[model samples]
Target chain A: MSSIAKKKGFGASLWDYLTTVDHKKIAILYLAAGGLFFVIGGIEAMLIRIQLAKPDNDFVSAGLFNEIITMHGTTMIFLAAMPLLFAFMNAVMPLQIGARDVAFPFLNALGFWLFLFGGLFLNLSWFMGGAPDAGWTSYASLSLASEGHGVDFYALGLQVSGAGTYIAGINFLVTIINMRAPGMTYMRMPLFTWTTFVASALILFAFPPLTVGLFFLIFDRMFGGNFFDHTMGGNTIIWEHLFWIFGHPEVYILILPAFGIFSEIFSLFSRKRLFGYSSMVFATVLIGFLGFMVWAHHMFTVGLGPTANAIFSVATMAIAVPTGMKIFNWLLTIWGGSIKVTVPMLYALGFIPSFVAGGVTGIMQAAAPLDYQLHDSYFIVAHFHYVIVGGVVLAILAAVHLYWPLMFNQMLSEKLGKWTFWFFFIGFHCTFFIQHFLGLMGMPRRVFTFGADQGWDTFNLISSLGAILMAIGVIILVVNVIITIVKNEKVGNDPWGDGRTLEWAIPQPIPFYNFKQTPLVRGLDTFWIEKQEGNKEGMTYAEPLSDIHMPNGSIIPLVMSFGLFVASFGALYNGEKDWAIPVLVLGLAITFASMAIRSIKDDHGFHVHKEDILKNEGGNK
Target chain B: MSHDAHVYSKSQTEYEYTRRVRREAMRGQVTTFAIMIFLTLIAFSAVAAGFSEYFIVPILLLLAAIQVVLQLYYFMHMSEKNHGMAAFFLYSGAILGFTLFLTFLTIVWWN
Candidate 1:
């Protein structure tokens, strides 16, 4: 176990990663997996764009187009964006808060495995029969009416991963609440930690409704349940209600971390204390609270009554106040400071206008009547891509560059990073900006192709061209990553030299147990404060050197998730396969047995002795 | 350390304060327990006595709600110091849940 840090063979490293519970290792695992999925989703995006490149194009069958778009949306949101954000959160949040690891390292592993297995199960649809084609939302009536097991895959796959998300969310909430280092008050916590806290709370409250909704969906399709079978006294609209309830908060959950990342970038590059810090925190919490109240805004076009629509419309618009406050705060943070236009700062600067554009459209949609015009149009598509791609995706890319040095102790090519940013940022606007006019010009969303006579040919082609540019940008990024990893130049700690938060205080090749002794956080941006006060070792130790207890890695999380994975197969094949019942039983038994073993086994974890700690020279400069 | 100090020579006043606090906690728990039992009986009797359906149903629900609060505050020690975060989260969750529940009752159940 002590030899875990030494460079080893691929097999050994693989085995270590498979069983390890260390947050740092788990973070790498998340990055690798999430990066793979992100590329896959990117490929799907390219395919969708190619199909829509020209009017009357026969690039893909209509049915296959449906599948492609669905997979693209589902994969990007559930698999790519969320996990990429999780990668950052897992990597940085604990470090930011001056904690060794998250509260439940084992559950952290479980969450990752569950997400992976569920994603695998979802993608397996491509090989099996078909992929879910009822849009990402999978609105009940359309989904139920659609033939085959596509919808089933959607329901069960999301169900599995949703559980993982829920677990991870709860873990973050507990970790943030309970695991802060001495003198690290809630008020003193970094904006990243605060965002993580609020997002986790959103995840906690939001994912349950998704779970229940998914179960209702699963039962409806698979087990002959009538939850959404309107013929049997079931209401399809209930699914809409349930889905949006989770769906709306899900947006905030994605964006808040993004907001956090950009906040860090803005402050770091600006080399200033965040402007309106408390108000930013207040806005985040207020946004989260308001997130729940306005789920009905999604259903406004569903005729949820004029009164309901009017109320929700007003409530939805109110969110803009806090969001607007955030935008201004970021702008003010950048005002008159020692600003460095690094690649990350470039994206952060680009993000303000992009996200603001997205926000204005959102408020427009909130008007309910305007939504009637925009619903199901490319405008909504443009709007969301503006938000998700503009905000979250940009943040992910920025964080990738911003924290690349922090994560790997190596610097990415600044030149290539800038290229990726310009190409992507410009390409993003080119792709979606015209789509707004296309929608206003009356082109609908999720339609694979339009006729040549529809007068949408040139614009569609432009959008596709923009997508191609974005793809080139992504390719450049991939190339950049390869070059960086291959070069592997060690740039020690605080490569940016303006790192404000606790994470940058830790020296390069951060040890498994992040901090040797949990550092005393004197104030916000604790590391910056210490740096200012001329603390050479980069921090003040809260406690003296002592034996640190660390959890041993176990394969139980993998086995438990595999149990669910296997059970999903059984559930999918329930009526058709002769062996489905036995398989289901076996899977459930495996899960229960694993859980029992976990509970019964007296694994108190191992301790890193004080002598060993002294021998390992870590962050101490 | 506190246990060792108690085992050694605790001041009379300190011991008395500790005992008094425990006694009060015990009394609160017992009182809440009795109230819960009485509420349960009332719920049962109201159903058993065949009152109006609406009356019995609402009454039972109200009693159940009260009992839950009693359980959380008394038996679960949520009223104690340092439980503010717990209380905040629990109530937040409850409020969110109730909002969803009300939405279902009003809109989805009919539609």
Candidate 2:
């Protein structure tokens, strides 16, 4: 009954988070869960390096190594990188557009819980059975042959998580399209919001094919279906086409938002308006469109014939045009402006050359004839890591440093952050750069070990050393996070002096309902415009204060996600166990009954009265 | 956040104009409905008439396409002004789906 700050017991706080429908709280949930998976994936990476450190050392068995590598790729891409980016998106996008919450708050919570449970179910594979040893791509040819319950876990877990991702994607699309505040036109939105919009659209178009492919995989593996079995009048290549159709855009889905993050960092630290803003937006969209055109490039070596390969080859190389434009736009953004080498700005500067290096190698491989030579080689490995780590991971780190204050009202230690960056940046190149040459020297990727006499020994040793350095960097980051949380030093709004978006304009400890009065977005960099015009309040309100209607918290989303989690286990054990059918039925029944209850009950939310708002304004200020 | 609705009374001319517009819209809807029914009957008769297989198939497909457009424009109100976003996304998805199918046909199946 009270709106003032009241510290509750740990149990109450735990329950609050469990049922919370607030976007900010959901964002925190995503951050914590995604961060946990990042560490898990990092450990997997370290294990791989340790195994590969010295030739034929046998730190891990070959089968376990396969599982480690597969889990590393799967966990990093699906669980760690995408969800971390989603954390920033969920935390910042609505605020950037000046919306109180996403268009669907309950669905937002459901999305996070679904993602968490899905990740948990996938990780549980390590204990229940051997992890999925087929590569992260899990091509039908390999996955269908793999014994044990590992691939089953991969298919069912991804199905659960992918649904969550699809839902989140749709939620973001609707929120961006329909929920902008008055005067916040599409053109006036921040780069992060623009990128989130494009990425969500990519998700909308991309996830369906993944869903289809995973279903075929599940059916082929668990049921007696032969969708990929050649003896049964089914072709395996269909899986490749379906997977890459989803997979290729999935990379764009990750990196475009990374581009958006760096765009913000570059402009913010340089204290300049983004140069060629329209062109940057254009390039982001162009890249997203072209993303769909180049899925065939990943299949060039699959023997689709010279004509198909040539057509796809050109399409793949053409993506560089927009990407090159983006690189130059960042350069121009930093040109002649007051560039501060903050941790984030440092990452942005590091990103340009690193991503370009990755892009060049990518173009080299896009030539079908050349890709035939590089296929399944560590050179291919180097090319992707250079982009993924050098691009997406770097952006994730920079955004963490950049947005930490906005999210938590406390700043991460700048010195420690810079330390983490250097180790990570150096270790990233050191780890993967040599692998390109190792690949050329005939070291195939995903191998458990190589002979000491094969001339790859020294390079593999160096790469493993570099992986250690990267792990140290991550460890330092974890330490930094723990320290920041423990200190909990409060900071005021616009902690970054040069904030440009609406997110930075709100008072510290942003209200559960963001923006008590809807903000009037005049133009790009709306906050900067307000500050320059000597507005002490740091925003121009479009409307007078009024009672704010907020959705009530509910446990339905958690229960809904948990039901799927339970059902996944049942589905995973379908033919193998007697209890599986009942469990599956019970789980579906739980989900459906809860859904029916939700539809039947009318839970109109309460309003925060105008008097309550005014009372809080004094304390917040 | 007051939820009170304000009621407005139309002038006599305004009321007449609104009524005329609604009547015209209704007339247009009814005509479209009749045309759709006539097209369906033609399709059924053509099938019932036992035309050559090739001729019948193409005609049926063409008629079905026409029906889809008519249903979308008239019944679904896709012709309305505010449906631009919906239309854009729908068309984009359709094009993407077509492209995927074309790719599969050429590379995966045709070979």
Candidate 3:
């Protein structure tokens, strides 16, 4: 929370990050961890492509391939995409609404550490035994059949991380609901804030089902409770129902924020107010609501009967209406005003056509009978990749380019950015576009290899080549990030001059307490409104400057998360190890002790007095 | 804007406004308690009476739900202003949970 500039040693910086409760700093933590996992998942993806590149290739055994694929999906969805999106939400949403900080900054730090520990625990499966081979969904029948501790890692790790995700969701919900500065009404909130709100709600409702499902997985595997054991009168399909019930909304939980990022980009870069802004809000919430009703669509091939299938199919397709509303609104937003094709905007432009293709395929799969053909095929694979990659990944990348200055006070190389986008975009279409055809040509997904005589070799090679191209693009992005960080050339507020929101209002090197005085958010694009009126300050204060009360940083969150990480190992070896029970008890004691200390401690936190503030301000501004 | 001066003696009108609001709140709580007790008694009698299991089940569920709503609105004070966000989330969670339950009942229970 230090506003004063200082240079510190590496160890001091490390210690600061480890204990910091600041939202902006926490965003950096998420970005660093999620980026590492993203690279891990990417390597896993490349391995998968390589194994399938040529017919009967022995790059990886079938068993190892299953492990790789399972980890890739689980890591990308849980560890990478969601956290990256969270990074943006943490970094920008509070600023956008003109809040000094999030509602519960300590809880925010707790969420990050919990996620990090959980992800570490899960990935440790590679050395502990083998990784989960039952796929990311961890369907009960397959996961129960899995012999090693892989599925245990998947279930327990997700449980821990999912709890963190749920906590973060609640934190954001409370922040957005209560912490808006004077006059920042729900209707007046930026689309990103609105989308974060809806997405948090989605997380609130969606994650419980996953928790229940994972608990079932854990009980069946570790405790021998037979929640999904068919012999014990438990039905495996019940797991599918529960998983998809959570799983479907989880998709929206990822995409809606991505949509928010794109919406911000379209409006800001195009120099226009977001078109049909209310409808866009409506669509976001509508998408979240509709997201729940369509879980059964994923289960269409699971034999839920014709009536169930028909209902779910139609409900799933009905979602296209609100989604179509969003797409058209974006098209109309950039229709007339001004269009600047910056890196983020270029990605936004690329997104429309790519996501539409994905949506079209999604509708195709929504048709139950058609899904009968496409389900578990490479086509389904292509369809989801389009949506997740083209929609969410594009948005994350675009936002990184867009908000880098805001987060780090440095700009990424835009010249290299276009090169990254084209390579990734072209490579994305090349890899997945052919997979759709492969699915249509009777090629199944999750296959380690195919017979060369089947005539799938050419398409497989082409897709592999495309994957390599995509890898090159990601590597370039890494290089670009390195160059930018090394250069660290400082940039000012509203780095893009056509800044539209309150996030753009603050000056370079954002103050520890974001707004020195809580800004009066008059309307949508509040800072833009002030800037239009020639207010160089880009804001009008709701109140006079006063002493600011701020929370002190604590290391309890890391310790608490580490407690769970230790306990997970104990749980993993339940009856097999004699020390397991004692270990579990020890871990629980540590966690509870930390909690007790947090509760009993009387740290009221210090405030910056007006004299010190005025002194700091006297010579600065 | 100092806290010490802002906490200085309040005017008579401000005290009267606080008194009126408290009285209204008290009355609302009393009425809600009476209604909740009545709903619970009805739930018990539905089980006490000899009726079809289906009839008793729906009746008990309905009555229980009504009581829960009362508890949230009155006892928990979610009905009060500034709890709009709370109400939205409560209803949203309820709708999603109920939807999941119904889907499970329709698809899973049948098999």
Candidate 4:
């Protein structure tokens, strides 16, 4: 109720965060949770590398190795990368578009809690009995044969989290479509906002297939359903089709935001307008559309018939045209501009050739016959890491440095950031580059260990050493974060001094209601345009300052997510535990009761009066 | 002042025009509802009349598709102005769903 800025006690702050529907606080929650999972996934990766560091090594048992790899892939993709990107999207997208908040703030909170609880439930598998060992894909035949409840955890946990992702996707789509400030036409929207729009569209269309596939898996395992039971006239290939249908678009959903982030960085540091802006937008939408048509490329080795393979092969290769257009666009963006070799710009410069390398390998695999040669080998492994790590991971590191000032009113050490970049970049290439040769040398992927006679000893050792260097880089990053937070050196808005968007126009330590008055975005890079026109405020007010309506924080989202979390355990234990049915019913009842209460209660959100806004502005000065 | 809601009194002519438009919309909705009921009845009768299984099934599907279009346009007011984005998303979802089924039929079930 207090409109003026005031510090709260620790418990009060904690309670505020727990009930917050504010996009900024929810973003911080996502960052912290996603960072935790990133580290966990990193540790799992290290375990993989250490186990493979030497020939015939037995650091982890074979079974545990499977579990580690599965968790690493599932956790990194579902929990770490996607949420980290969402963290950025939540933090910056609304600001870029000059919106006060996302369309559904309550659903936004629910999405975060659902993801957190789902991730928690999935990780709990390690302690409960075992983790899923059927690989991240969890192919039906393989998963159906796997013992214990590991695969069940995989299915149900993803079901809960995927729903969250789906909701978040719809939320973003709606927000971008409906929430742009006055004079901010669709064509005038920043590249980051445009890419977010397309990425959210991909998520909206893509996630339903995953939900359906996961449901099929859940029912088959838990309720004696025979959807995947080939012995009962079920076809196993259907799972492959469903999983890839979702999985292919899932990659785009991760990468498009990455593309958006890099596009922002490239333009910001270059001190120039994005090169071929419309084409960049065109390429993004093109990639999103093409993303759906080529899922079968992943299954070229599955003998989906020569005709099917040929059609998909051609479609897969066609994606490179748009992707290549993007690469050239970024390069041209940096060409002849007053480029600042800042940490983010450094990553953007590094990303071009690295992503191209990944894309070229992708084209190679698009040739169905060539894929047969590379399938299930270290080559396939190398190709994905190149795209994902080289592209998305690099963009993530860059955005961390770029948006650190925006998120927290402080700056990370520039020196430490550059050092982290070099170490990580070099380490990444060193780790995956030789894997191509190793794959060509006939070494396979997912094998726990190889014998000395396989001629892969030295390369595996090098790959492991590279992984160690990457870990050291990450450790340095963690140290950098700690140092930054502890120092808490406050920064002003436009900390980068070359900010090009509306986000940088806001005051430092941004208020909960982001913009006091909605900004009139005259064109792309609106802040830059304002700066060029000698505007001191870096903004043009769309209207006079007025009362702003803001949603109240609520705990219903957490309770609802908890209901699903509790229900997952019940479903996991069904047919085996005596109380499973009761637990299931109880959990659903809790969820439904919370829903009823939410619908019945009328919460007309409070408004900050113009008088309070004036006082707050004075206090800020 | 910006937050204050302003109540505007419409001119008599404007009020009459709005009333006529609403009445026309209601008529359209009622007519569409009747047509949807007729389509459903035809589908049900086709099933009950012991036609060839293939003939009945396709006809029922066709009728169902028509009913869906009517439902979306008339009942859901998708034909109204300002529903462009909603319509776009709905059709996109339909197209994507259709593609998935077609792919499934060709690749999974047929092969």
Considering chain A alone, what is the TM-score of candidate 1?
Answer: 0.99
Runs in model 2 with CA error above 4 Å?
A1-3, A618-621, B1-18
* CA displacement after TM-score superposition, residue A211 of candidate 1 (Å): 0.9
State each model's CA lDDT, in order. Answer: 0.91, 0.91, 0.91, 0.91
- lDDT by residue for model 2 (A275-342), tens: 89999999999999999999988888788999999989999999999999998999999999998999
Q: Second chain only: TM-score per model?
A: 0.86, 0.85, 0.86, 0.93
Q: Point out where model 3 deviates above 4 Å.
A: A617-621, B1-5, B42-55
Clashing pairs in 4: none
Q: What tens-digit string does per-residue lDDT give for candidate 3 at A373-404? A: 99999999999999999999999999999999
For model 2 chain A, where is the 10-residue window of minimal lDDT? A612-621
* RMSD in Å for all candidates: 2.2, 1.6, 1.7, 1.6
> Which sequence of candidate numbers ranks them by DockQ, best first?
4, 2, 3, 1
Model 1, docking class: acceptable
CAPRI level of candidate 2: acceptable
The chain A TM-scores for the candidates, taken one by one, are 0.99, 0.99, 0.99, 0.99
Q: Which residue pairs clash in candidate 3?
A: none
lDDT of 4 by residue, A246-340 (tens): 99999999899999999999999999999999999999999998999999999998888999999999999999999889889988998989989
For model 1, residues A157-271, the per-residue Cα lDDT tens digits are 9999999999999999999999999898998888888999999999999998889989998898888899988799888998898899999999999999999999999999999
Q: How close is candidate 2 to the true structure, as a TM-score?
A: 0.98
